[model samples]
Target: MNLVLIAMIAAMLIPMYEAWKDDNIWQKMLALASISSKAGIMTLFISVLRDDWMIGVVGAIILTVGNAGLMLLAHVIKRLDDL
Candidate 1:
């Protein structure tokens, strides 16, 4: 595993732990957690594809934020389901 990957996973620790403790919408939590995982993977992907560090960094940021936003969307959907 890459060091960046390790760091990314470590970053998710708090969110994952908190989400697991949250009984409501556990699936939603898991989906959110997966966003971090995907972000790391996407970063690795872009890094290997491009020699440009700036592009990789920017793309990774965008992808990661988009992933988390999807998770937030899921949360909203779950809450709406409750209504």
Candidate 2:
């Protein structure tokens, strides 16, 4: 279980590296989305391990709703770029 959390944390870093190294707006948005999802997943994992329902609910919310806002922002950015 600890190893799984560690692996997830490591996975999250890949996007950060990409966002840091690349200058593309799309890539940065994608990376931000990835990070958000990973964080939700990590929260879910921790909630499961701790047997906490409140935290689990929060995690579920993040998993379901977090990306929508990011995607909306991405779309706005894309539209602005196209203008």
- TM-score: which candidate is best? 2
lDDT of 1: 0.67
Steric clash pairs (candidate 1): none
In the range 1-83, model 2's lDDT, one tens digit per residue, is 88998999999999989789989888888998899899998998899899999998998899899899988999999999999
Q: What are the per-residue Cα lDDT tens digits for candidate 1 across 27-65?
A: 556757575666656666657766668767766776667
The whole-model lDDT of each prediction reads 0.67, 0.91
In terms of lDDT, model 2 sits at 0.91
TM-score of each: 0.43, 0.89
* Model 1 worst lDDT run, 10 consecutive residues: 26-35
